[model samples]
Target: MDPAVRMVFKNMTTDLAEQYPALVEPAKLILKKCNGLPLAIVTIGGFLADQPTKTAAEWRKLNEHISVELDMNPKFEVIKTVLMKSYDGLPYYLKSCFLYMSIFPEDRNVSRRRLAYRWIAEGYARDKATADRYFMELVERSMILPTQQSVCSIQGFDSCQLHDLIRDISIAESMEENLVFRLEEGCSSNTHGAVRHLAISSNWEGDERELESTVELSRIRSLTVFGKWKPFYISDKMRFLRVLDLEGTEGLRNHHLEHIGELLHLRFLSLRGCHEIFYLPDSVGNLRQLETLDIKGTGIAMLPRTTIKLSKLCYLHAGSGSGDNEKTYFSKCEDICEMQRDLCVGCCSLDLSDLDGFGRCEAFHLVCCLMYPNIIRGIEDSGVKVPRGTRKLKALRTLRYVHLAWGIAIIKEIKGLTGLQKLGVVGINKKNGPGFCSAISSLSHLESLSVRSGDGLNGCLDGMYTAPENLQSLKLSGSLEKLPEWIKGLQNLVKLRLELSKLSGNLETMQVLGKLQNLSILGLWDDGFKIDVLRFQTGLFRRLMVLDLFYSRMEIKLVEFEEESMPNLELLTLSLGDTEIAFSGLELLQSIKEVRLSVHSYLFGTPKSSKNGGNEKMGKTLYEMMKREEERNKPMQDKVRQELQAQLDRNKNRPVLKVQ
Candidate 1:
């Protein structure tokens, strides 16, 4: 056996005795089978540690067969054992965290702090101290592994991740525990009793029995059932219900859904993706607590006018619909969309004229819709025009997707909206149009700007990159001939995305880009880059960590570069176009951690066969870096542990003199 394997085995045997003092002999037998594999030893030991009783012989035989017969590495087995033990030992709070990982695709890295906060919001971590403390402890105990992270401690402790094996285990355990409600084909009704959250897919055809069984699941708080089942009656027994997501219901009839309004606690309701739900009950407006109402892709073309009664609604995704019924228009939604007093009826081309009746408004929008009855009449009565100049929306702050004929009049009006922080618009004209660059150049508070240039973002190309110094994201979509030359200036911008742009300039742009220092994510797509004609150094993008280039080409100039040049690069995606020379420079990206390549089948690639050596070395380096980071953070962990221990000790030592 390899010496490394032997050393690993010794470490496990010693740890097992300490954890399970009573089951020493059986523990040794388990270790022998594990062959010093930390995974199996920890898993089996942890499981046995949680169990109150287990015979030595019984433990020994199971260990022998699993370790030797299966030829399993003991270390891997220990991981499994510990995971099972931790899962079984978890209180409801941690179990929820473990199960929720299933929501992400396999191998996905979940942020620890984000997960903690989600748990907090879900009421699982109501007591922040307990939740945060245990969250770190779980990671330390090897129940979850910390993923590649920007900081050693996020909020507190490092971001965490679960191994694919452990994640699978969690999923299996969650299903068995009835924590997950997966309503799939051939699903038996027997499992319905224990399910607390149910997700029904599109193929879930329900008969009367299934419907009754569903109703019986009254304890469920979150339900996402797909498919258009018959509009059967639903009872108000769903008292604990919080989220009801039924999308793509293609065959729902006139549902006797009157009682659903009784669920005052419901927070999220989704009727989108439903093809046949024609009418909404007026009682739906009674859900004052509703926060999100998504009815975008439903057969119900118009909404019940009472929907505005749901004053608490925050997110409403009401897209275009076609029907003869009157639609519900919210003074609130209208305000958010920057629509003044009148509703722009897209189909009728009628503008709502009763603008003065709108009690108060903050913002307005009329994207690609010119309607009659003049909705702007109400705003005009209140001394507000279609914001035709760069005017500060002093009373308003967020303006998103306001469409106007790409003209100077609208541009000047937009400048008046100085208070605007989020602004998105499309250029209707394909030719020349006045750009918004000079107008919004001084809007120092602008954080997000998304614009569609005329003839592929051509009119706005020169001044596209100018914005507030604090701007975090700049997204330019639609047709464009090349990457804007001005993009090199926005040093503060962290995220930049260019869509449908066939860019030709190279090297100089790449060099300038490498100097941005703060650039973390760069995605260039829509036709390939003219790499051969470009004279840029690959090593110039030193600070870039994530590079996504679809249908992009690059010329290799450097043969060898230090690993630290692009030290932070972790994710790389490059399309393998009809070029083999481009991959020669891939090695220059020494910090590459994960590479996703879409290579043509016929493109012979040497990286596939030979470049693995560098990847292996890179993996080792990353692992060493992580271990060092962990060691560096040891003191902090110790400090927290000590604090907790002292608190526990003080409580134990406190004087509690019994009274007679």
Candidate 2:
């Protein structure tokens, strides 16, 4: 074995002994079988560390079984052991969700929002929050590796993927349990016993025989079809079905949903990405047990007027995608070009006045107007409006993108939503600003709030005396002449995005924001702020991990960090906007892991003038200067890199952070 592999093995063995001293011998045996494969060893070790009982006898048994399986399947010995052990260790609640991953296509990112809702609808968990916990557990165990989990951590969109080995094992185990029946192109379902859940993949085109003759359709509990198929009248026979996910089905006209009321047990229905579903039947109101109704990215402009009957519904997604942008792992579903005009719910005159039955709903998400204000004007001009009576949803927790026409009545109703944890809306004007400010203060449970003000957010903040104590994430986009007085009170704020703020003066508000101990990410976009000389005070922003001020090149010219300021900051982004950096006491702070500078202007001919002064220009960003004279950005960039590198080398533990 290579020296590197040997060192890793030795280090891993020592860690295992520390974690489970009693099972060290069995761990050694497992590691021997792994042959220094780090993934298996680390995964298995983590798994054992979480075990309820760490008896040596039980581990010896597991070790012996793994060794025997390795000999039998020499091709994929280590991975099989790790996967099988992981599956066996899962609690009963997570077992089903683990198996359900096999339903998605190979190498596809499983949507966190989509899957969590499915689990809630399928009665796998009590509610959406419970289902989310199950997902977090899987992620913690490494069974599901989330794509860009950190990118959207603040936004709450956690999508993930299953490794191929884990995927295959899930598929095989699902078949053995008779929990899922995957219908392939020429394959027929086994009618030997009752198969409860069935899925038709995109590549499969099974004939009618595969559904009617092979399996008893009435016994099916879940039917998920991701293919080109006509399931127009199939709901009549699947009376016992609880979940009908037709997200990718085509040509689904009103006839498809006409008889949907017959399935009394149906709880979850998905029409996302369905191009042919122009209209829905009134029978949709009959699913009193339904928990989730996903019509996102579909051609359905209007829902059945009797939608109030679904009193049990908790999650309703009516938007193609939200405006709260974050780079996720999954690709957006292919658009149905034929129904493009009428498909988006935002562009239509959707009068959402009669959804009073959504009183029990926890999450009510609609594309109120994540679109630009100009696009919204062109779309919602013809009387499309989000009506009043949302206060009726006392149980509501997440209400997003509501185009509140801005009045006393609307603001009063909003104040009644005391249980709200997350909310997003296109705000009202000055006439209703007082009421809106009062309402914002009343909702004490708000953890995440996103407001896109049509008439400037300053009006809404005018009367605000206090911020939500628990508010952690906030996104505000609009004109801002002054900082909100309530902002300093939000000590729990973790992520904040302030857009289009023309801030200036003594930088008092910036200092207040810097003192927030829990702040993790801060983004200042176009027209954010203008300060001549920005200085960081020591002992401020101690818990910040990502500080993103890299915007509007030339807007900020000079910045200096005092020692002990931002001691834990891992990522710092600065827009070289018309200004250069002056590092003060930078050598004292050695915890910085990365520094990103977006330089838009710097003169090469005058290096001394560039450092001693500020010169705004347009040219190639990264270019080399004469070898003896100086590098293109020798005054700032090259020197800064060299100093940081020296600090990192002296620390020994900190690796050289990538500078871009």
Candidate 3:
């Protein structure tokens, strides 16, 4: 049994420790039926946990019945029954959503975004964000299990899977309800009744003919093609479909999309991993009712102007989610917003080539301005152009990834979205000057602002810019000569990040930052300071908890926190070179909890080859190329090991160190 499952087993057997001692031997046999599944273990454990005596006698009675069922029914319907209880316990709204998961293969990791979109299309929830709650409920009930990363992340888990044993029950229940069917190529099975939804299982090569024969295609409202089966053209007869998920379908091209517009009721359409596609047909813009459009990794570089007509579309994961992971996080800002309103707006992303159509974002919520200049040029060269008419978005609270290179005219256009609370823009310079900063001050409601002026390029803010008093987080890059004076007025500032290499060596610059009474976390990157020593003045940084310092151009050899400075400091992350610094500052921090030191050293080296046939310029033979590389550990390694040993020997006599 896996350790986690074994721990659950131990916790369950606690009730029988004393009274049903002899029955434990029999209980182990019964537990084997669970196959070490946490769901099964937890389910059976709950049954024992509620026993009147919590004794072996009660467990023994349950065990005997389970034993008889196991012997008479090899499938161990007893365990299946326990799993079914969880499924049956689901709320009315979540039942359909849970069963829908049965379409996916067992042990397959399902994308949370994919589920959110599909669930919304199926009318399981009002929108994509609402549907996310339904998924979390299932995992909470132990009906599904989450991956490791999901559990550790502060961000909610994005994927989950079902145990094989649990999957079997879900499949059986799904079939019994006639809710959906799992179709495969070789399997010659047909659904008995009206199949409302169908999942063409992965590895299925059968085409449209196989689909028509197995199910009444017209009645199916939702169709999900998981693997490589290509339905060149969907039938016009399947009219009621509100959801068409072709996530991993192969060879979806211009012709495949010709009839898509006819499905008037379609709400969700996905082509997330369809790498075969290089361009999308203009007809895709006809799905006016479309709520979510995901083409995250598709090779298609530009979208048609017709997409601007999708007024119903709110969430658009249009470009590389990885290229700008930080910029793409549009939800975090919305979630923490203390203000809430029943407002509506639509957002569209325009590449340089698709500039003919204008998009919308409203009520200070979200407006993603693509801020990279070179990227803007590439997109414009590809066919993206500016919209034909004036676009107004009064409700947008957030504007993300805005590229100022779109022209100052674009800035004037966005100035109308006065409600923006969060904004991230790049491509600023002496040419634009404080006009960008002056425009930023107009967003009085803005709480978070991020501006990046590319490498070696300087942007001057000066006194003309007005910093929003409510601003809580600010990230600034580029050749910022000094922190703008407006920063002193940001009484609500909570987080600050700076990345400018030409930072002045002045200590007063840092002292001013530390004076921010409400600031708790600070990150200094790319030679944030030109000084050799960073000294914290006493009575400053009273509430700061995390301080991250990275080294690139400028190197700091010493960091000293004055006696009363950083009274609540908890974590200090240091990126340093071999220049020796003092460890005494760490002792001065009254609330110091952890020290993460990334020692920068020149240790990694490719040893020079003495005997090499490649030196003759003919290059090495296949044998040499295929040969295992030699490992080198020399006097440096030995010296380091000896020093480490000496440090350990010195510490051995002292008190043991504890890690928090």
Q: TM-scores of all models?
A: 0.50, 0.67, 0.60
lDDT of each: 0.52, 0.63, 0.60
lDDT of 2 by residue, 453-509 (tens): 535666666787987899999877666777777888888999987765554223676
Write one digit per residue (lDDT tens) for candidate 1, span 116-200. 4335434566533455776776775556766654311113344666654566676677677777656666766663575666666
**For model 1, what is the error of residue 474's alpha carbon versus the real structure, in angstroms, after optimal superposition?**
3.3
* lDDT digits (tens) for residues 91-131 of candidate 3: 89988888888888756788887888788778888864478
User: Could you tell me how far off, in angstroms, the CA of residue 29 lies in candidate 3 after the best superposition?
Assistant: 19
Model 3: per-residue Cα lDDT at residue 397: 49
Please identify which of the two predictions, 1 or 3, would achieve the higher TM-score against the true structure: 3
- The C-alpha local distance difference test score for the whole of candidate 2 amounts to 0.63
> What TM-score would you give candidate 3 relative to the actual structure?
0.60
Model 3 misplaced stretches (Cα beyond 4 Å): 1-78, 103-105, 108-114, 127-139, 148-158, 163-175, 184-189, 192-198, 219-238, 244-260, 273-280, 298-302, 321-377, 380-403, 416-457, 460-660
Candidate 3 RMSD computed on C-alpha atoms after optimal superposition onto the true structure: 12.5
